[model samples]
Target: MSEEPTTPKELSVRSLTGLILSAGLAVVGLFILPVFRSFGLAFRPAFWLVLAIEAVALAGVVISVLTLHRQRTLD
Candidate 1:
């Protein structure tokens, strides 16, 4: 059977939530790489700045997951 083509207008809430979740994961993954290489710089202000941003990304991931759970229960 042929799958129906998905248009922007047809996108479901679950798909959008998944997209947000994926984006948050990617951000966290990319941000974490610098931490491993910047051990010497860990005491600097820049390291803490980056860590704060990473924490925000992590929060986003958590929120998106909760949103998915709510959607699943509603369905």
Candidate 2:
């Protein structure tokens, strides 16, 4: 048996949800990091590096959302 393809509506909803969640998490992390700082680790270079990684992840999520929207519209 073969798996059925997902409809554009389903894909758009799922992708949009994922993008929002990812962006939310990144924003929350920015706010929470300063609240739990231990000996200024949150202000250190490594901390900023991790934040940069999260920013990149957020960008990827945004791209994915745009791609899904385009695909859904094309369908």
Candidate 3:
């Protein structure tokens, strides 16, 4: 049997931190934004910020999943 000739790139500390932050932002957006909106006190900027954060979090999740799939395939 033959294995892959190269190793996959490891995620850097900064990159991992950013991913964790993104996931946190996603949780805030998923859980908090609605409550704010429900209270009817949130402004336009808050809404936009939450949306942007959620988008970034979603992107991070997609990238992470794809990377795991690639690594699995290599294995």
Candidate 4:
């Protein structure tokens, strides 16, 4: 019996950018945030910094999804 080969799809530029941004944010949230929290710095400027990063990451993901959807519809 012969098996068919599977091909991988390439990510668009926007998709790749969003993936990278989101992954970087995830790393910050997982590592940096906890460190700040452990040091009892959550009430300081660190809170605002983390909040801004989260908001930007969320916006990037949303924009990426919307653009990808529009691109697909246009195609």
Candidate 5:
């Protein structure tokens, strides 16, 4: 049996979807953090900074997914 993905297009689509979901969840977390503060979760300025970093990471995942999708399409 081959180890490499035989259907790269499908893989790309799945990866893209996962990345989008991850990014969406991260965005939701960013918004919910403040709300959590009302429950004594402690919404510090550094937390916002961490959220910004998470957003960037999610963006990177999205970029990677797009790149993979494009490469699969070109193939």
Candidate 6:
């Protein structure tokens, strides 16, 4: 029996960027945010900081999806 060949598709740059941003933000937010709070940046400021990180990550994912769709359409 012959095995069928499978073609591998490369991930788009936007998608990779999204993944990196999401991961980096999560790591930084998890590790660094507490330190900032401990250093005296109390509730509201720290809350806003977390919100900003979440917004950026969400935007990255949205842009990545849009770019991927556009790229596929072009291909």
lDDT: which is higher, 4 or 6?
6
Each model's C-alpha lDDT? 0.60, 0.68, 0.70, 0.68, 0.66, 0.72
State which candidate, 2 or 5, has the greater TM-score. Answer: 2
List, residue by residue over 1-75, the lDDT tens digit for candidate 6: 999975555568777777787767766765667876898999789878887887787787677766653322435
Off by over 4 Å in 5: 1-11, 45-67, 70-75
Per residue, candidate 1 scores C-alpha lDDT tens digits across 4-75 of 974333335774676586676667666664675566554456556666766676776666656553322323
Lowest lDDT 10-mer window, candidate 4? 66-75
**What TM-score should be assigned to candidate 1?**
0.43
Pairs of residues clashing in candidate 5? none
Candidate 3 structure quality by residue, lDDT tens digits, 1-75: 998788666655555666677678788787776776777756786688678878889898766655542332444
Clashes of each: 0, 0, 0, 0, 0, 0
User: Which is better, 2 or 3, measured by lDDT?
Assistant: 3
Scored by Cα lDDT, where does model 3 land?
Answer: 0.70
lDDT for predicted candidate 4 compared with the true structure: 0.68
Pairs that clash in candidate 4: none
Best by TM-score: 6
lDDT of 5 by residue, 1-75 (tens): 868867544456666677777777777666676566766666586477557767776776777576655444553
Model 2, residue 33: distance off in Å is: 2.1
TM-score of every candidate: 0.43, 0.50, 0.48, 0.53, 0.47, 0.60
lDDT of 3 at 49: 67
From the highest TM-score down, the ranking of the candidates is 6, 4, 2, 3, 5, 1
> How do all the candidates rank in terms of lDDT, highest first?
6, 3, 4, 2, 5, 1
Local accuracy of candidate 4 as per-residue lDDT tens digits, 13-70: 8776786787678567655666777877755677776777788778777777665432
